[model samples]
Target chain A: MLAESLALSALLFTIGVVGVLTRRNAIILFMCVELMLNAVNLSFVALSKVHGVGGQVFVIFVMTVAAAEAAVGLAIIIAIFRHRQSVNLEDINLLKG
Target chain B: MTFDLLNPVQLSSALLPDLLLVAGAILLMLMAAWRPDSDARQRTVGFASIGLLVLTMGLVVWMAVSGLTASDKGVIAVDGFRWMVDLVVLLGAIGTIALAIEHNVRDGIVQAESHVLVLFATSGMMILAGARDLMVVFLGIEIMSVAVYVLAGLNRRSARSAEASLKYFLLGAFATGFLLYGIALVYGATGQTQIVEIGNAIRRFDLTNDPMLLVGIGLMLIGMGFKVAAAPFHMWAPDVYDGSPTPISAFMAATVKAAAFATFMRIWYEAFYNMFSGWAPSVWWLAVVTMVVGNVVALSQKNIKRMLAYSSIVHSGYLLVAVTAASALASTAFTFYVVAYTLATFGAFAVVASMQQLGETDARISDYEGLWHVRPWLATAMAVYLLALLGFPVFGGVGFFAKWYLIQAALAAPAGLTILAVILVLTSVISAGYYLQVVRVMFMKPRPEGAPEPLPVGSLTRAVLAVTVVLILGLGLFPSRLVEMTQMNAFPRYPFSPALQMGQPQFRR
Candidate 1:
């Protein structure tokens, strides 16, 4: 069971990385990041069978941090949207050197 | 088994500065939220936040003095090392708060929120520097980063600042993903998150060949590399550093790097000491690439902030050299080098802050020309710092000695870090090319016509510059004292020293 879940988690994480790499929209990029975090959460829960409560406790922290990151990331996306009238990463090149 | 747990009182005392900072942050946050946004009220809140940072520094100093090495809760490690880093973080926070409030007043932004954020961020840094558990490390990083994400966008009026904030948040979150996955994989491999326990597990299982564990370690290294803006993972640093407020740039470049390096060293030295063969070579390559890229790219930058950003990346490479050496002596040199770099970097940024007009940073390198003609004292102070950054002899007391200490640490390692040391020296010379260009522009180039009048320097910024110049010279000339202090505080002492190579057991066979 643990091996199966770990494999699933790895697959999901790879998908998330692909989404982040290929996506241009800021909102989707953040969603992909969240996907990656949740993928790790799955691994933690599955591994907890052997690791005991430490893995579970860490999952909680990861979930909470993900929540906070989402809130902040969304706010920043909105701020950028207002400025450029878009949240596409392509349009946000005002700072590139 | 020595990990203490369930002692609330001892834990609170162990966390004295953290308690004060949390209380102060909450107090300031409440005041900022409830009070009307007015200049006087903002000033009051800003000054109060600076006062809080001072109190935290005083308490950390007292703890360091009185010998507070309590490690309750199984997650904290309050030692001389963590205390020293806390003091640096606090000093950095104070300078940043001073810059934040002053910049806000000039830009008409209410600064109370920035003060609160800085206090919270510093508390997070202390926790990070002291963390003994991987879980605690993750929490500390999240705390520090969430605050910084907000602080980056605080200048919502400027579209560029907003873009910087958005970009930082996106990439930062991506990095956090890498870190979380690494922790998960490590936990899966060892079933342990506590540093000492993980070390024991590795030995008991002879887990060096465990592919899962090796991959986990690599991922964690990548995650941390991104945080410190090391080569190949440093795409976000220039934009983030240039777009954020200058004071925060100074803070991030100085204390954030310091805290991240501290944690990186602790995790590797304490938990993975026996696995140096697997990891050291990768870090060596990172050092080479970071040094080459950082210095070479910096030579082409016209914006002074961007130039400094790249310069910081090069300094990160030097510090990474210290980490790769991974000896008690190396850790000590790392600490002393951090102090010198923080003082010098902050001092340079403070002088840059004086060049601000109406809240925007006019950081074109040419703007520095004829600076000596108008503000000789400020220009001279900047030169001292630039010289220190360049690691020039005679004038660069701390910088020179700091590099010397780093080389000694590299040479002390049983493995051949000699080449890394040689590369570090060559990069220092390459770094001088851009660093000296700045000095030349400031002292020798003629200020072009239509040059803006010199902005007024606040008494507070002036004081930071004065202290930095003096400290750079002091640390350079009398480095023995500071080096001795680090010698006492250094962690993961001789048992796990890189010279021992505890993993291989037969090096020359």
Candidate 2:
């Protein structure tokens, strides 16, 4: 059960990483990041069965921080969307080197 | 006396500076919201934030001088290392707010909450400086990064600022995922979240070669690599620094980097000291790559902000050299180097802020051509700052000694990083290519015929420049005093030694 859960968590994390790299929409990219965080949360919860409650406690912290990150992330996306009518990453190129 | 954090009194005492800053930040946040947002309100909040930072710095110094220490099981460190880093972070925060008060008015950023956010971010940095557990480290990084993410976009009027915020937020969050996963895996491998306990577990269980632990460390390195803007993982820094308002850029470049590096040093030195052979080579390569990429790319940048961003990346590379050293002296060197770098970075950005005309964001290197003819004082101070960043001797001031100690630490490391030290020198010479180009433009190039005179330096900014310049030069001339201070506060060599862990004085006066 532990092995299977770890494998599932790793798979979800990989999917999230790929989505972040491949997606060009700003909102999608953020969602992918949230997906990655949740994947880690899954790993922590799964690991807590063997490692005691520390992993479970870490999961709570991760969730709270992820929520905070989401709030700030969405506010930033909204600010950018107000300027350019699009939420596409490619269109957000005013700061190129 | 050793602090047992389970005792509420001891925990509060151990966390006095962090608590004071957070509590002050909350009050200031209320003050910020109480006012109808205006330039006056922003200035008031900014000054109040500075005062709060100064007060916190006083507490940190008191703690350091009084020789507080925490038990090995404690979640927070109460040592000279934490106090020194807290001082650096607080000083950088004070300078950032001072510059912001003036810069925000020019950029039309009237939100008083911006100053409050700096306080919140700084409190997070203080948490980072002392965090001895992985969970605390995660919380501190998130706290610092989230506030900075908002601060990066504080100039709502500018699309570039918004873009910077988005890029920083996305990349920062992605990096946090890697960091958190690494923590989870490490926790799984060693069954401990406390860094000191992890070290003990590895030794007691002989888990040094455990694949799970190895992978966990690698992922944590990658995550930290991104935070410190080390190469290959540093894609987001240039754009973010260029687009953020100048003072915010300075804050990000100096204080934010200092806090992240402090936590990075602590975790590696304290938790993974037993696994030195496994991680040193990876860090060595990181230092080398970061140095080459930062200097070479900086040479071709036309925009001054982008150039400075690249330059900051290069400094991160230099600090990484100290990380690779992984010695008690390396931590001392790191602390000294961070102080000099913060001063020079803030001073340079202040000059950059003052050079801007109202509402204009463009700052080309060409604009600096012949600035000496019109603003001789500004030009000269810029020279001092640039030379310092270049690590040139004497005139570069404390920057010279900063590199000197770093090289000393690298050479004296147990691994004997001779080749890395040599590369460090070669890269310093390479860095001179860009740092001197700016100086050459100011001193040698004639003023453009139609150029307008640069605006007079604001009173607060002028004070910042004067203080940084004096310290840089003063410390440059008398570096021994600073060196002695760093030596006294150096990260303990044997972190787990019972004598040192028992709150005894580790260094002689």
Candidate 3:
């Protein structure tokens, strides 16, 4: 069970990384990051069976941090969108110089 | 593997500075939310934050002087080393706050929240500096980074500021993911989250070759490498620094680097020393590329903020050399180096902040042309800082010792870091090429035809600049006392650390 769950968690993490890299839309990119974080939580839960409750405890903390990050991250993304009328990463090049 | 939880009193005593800063930040937030209308209240809030930082600095120094040793059951480590870092972070916060006052008003940022965010970030840094467990480190980074991401975009008027904030947030969140994943895998491999316990597990269980452990270490390196703005992982720094408000740029350059490096060293050295031989080579490559890329690439940058951003990256590379050496001397050198970098970087940014007030944003290096003719004092201050950064003879006093001890630490270690030492020397030369350019523009170039009227220097800014300049030269001239102080304030080891594998033993050696 641990091995299979770890494999599934790793697969989710890989997809998250791929989505973050490939997607140009800012919202999608952020969602991918959230996906990556959740993937870590999944692995933590799966590994907790072997490592004890420390892994479970770390998951709760990661969840809290992830929620905080999402709140701040979305607010900033909306701020950018308001200025540029788009949340596409390529459109946010005013600072590229 | 069993451990005991610390008592509430014991924990509070150990965490006094962090607790105080948190309370102060909450109070400041309440005051801000209370009075959104009055400029007088805003000024009061700013002074209040400064007073809070000063109090925290005093508490940290007193604890250091008293030689208090407070470790809380392998979760938090409080000793001279942690206090020394706390002092730097607080000083950096105070300087940034002082710089922020005028800039915030000019740039139309809500003044009270800026100060509140910085206080919260400094508290997070305190947590990071004292953290002996992976969980604390994670929590600390989140607290610090989330506050700063908001800070970067505090100026909602400028579209670039929003861009910078968004970029920093996305990249920062990505890095946190890498870090969390590393922690999860490391825990899976070792069944532990505390540093010393992991070390003990590695030693006893012989899990060195576990794929999960190795990959976890690599991911953590990438994550931390990004946080410190080392090359290859430093894509976010220049754009973010260029776009953020000037004082916040200074804050990010000094405090963020110091805080992140503190945890970087604490985690790698304290928790993972058992795997030192396994990991040193990867760091060797990282140090080399970081130095070369940071310096060589900085030479092409026209924007002063981007130039400093790259220069800060180079400084991170130099500090990484100390970390890769992994010696007691190296850690001590790292502490003094943080102070040195903070003084010079903060001083330079102080000058930059004043210039930005004179109506220059996204300033080019050439904007410095004829600055000497206009404001010789500011020009000279800039010279002292740029020279100090280049580690030139007279002003580089602390920088010289910083690099010298770093080399000495590398040399003292087995022959592994010889190449890194050599590369460090080579990159210092490469860095001079750009530092000298800024000096040339300031000193030799004739005053430009259309230069703006000089900005009046704020009293608070003047104080920060004066103190940093004096300390830079003072520490440069009389470095040994500070060196001895840092060396004496060795890291506190966990109870589970082997007699042969701990910090006090290194001092005895």
Q: Kindly report the TM-score of the first chain in candidate 3.
A: 0.97
> What docking class should model 1 receive?
high
Give the poorly placed runs of model 3, Cα more than 4 Å off: B1-5, B358-360, B492-509
lDDT string for model 1 (B1-509, tens) is 12244487766677778888998799889998887777777778888988888888899888878865543336788778888889888889988888777777665577567778888888889999888899989989989989988888887888878887887888888888898898888888999998777877887787878889888999898989889999888888889888888888888888888888888888887788777777888888888899999999999999888889898999999999888886777888888888888988888888887787776744788888988998999899888888888877768768878878888998886675888888988888888899889888998988789998877888878777888898899878888898887876787344543334444332220
* TM-score quality measure for candidate 3: 0.96
Query: Whole-model Cα lDDT per candidate?
Result: 0.84, 0.90, 0.85
By TM-score: ranked, best first: 2, 1, 3
Model 2 lDDT tens row, B1-509: 77898798999988988999999999999999996999988888888999899999998889898887787778888888888999999998999999999998778999999999999999899999999999999999999999999999998999999999999999999998888888888999999999888877877787868989988999999999999999989999999998899999999999999999999998888887766767887888999999999999999999999999999999999999999887778888999999999999989988999998888787899999999889999999999999999888999999999999999998887678889999999999999999999999999999999887887789999999999999999999999999988888877535444223323211111
Q: What is the TM-score of each candidate against the true structure?
A: 0.97, 0.97, 0.96
Instruction: Give the number of the best model, judged by lDDT.
Output: 2
Give the DockQ-based CAPRI class for model 2: high
Model with the higher TM-score, candidate 2 or 3: 2
Sort by DockQ, best first. 2, 3, 1
Write down the C-alpha DockQ for each prediction: 0.90, 0.91, 0.91
Clashes of each: 2, 0, 0
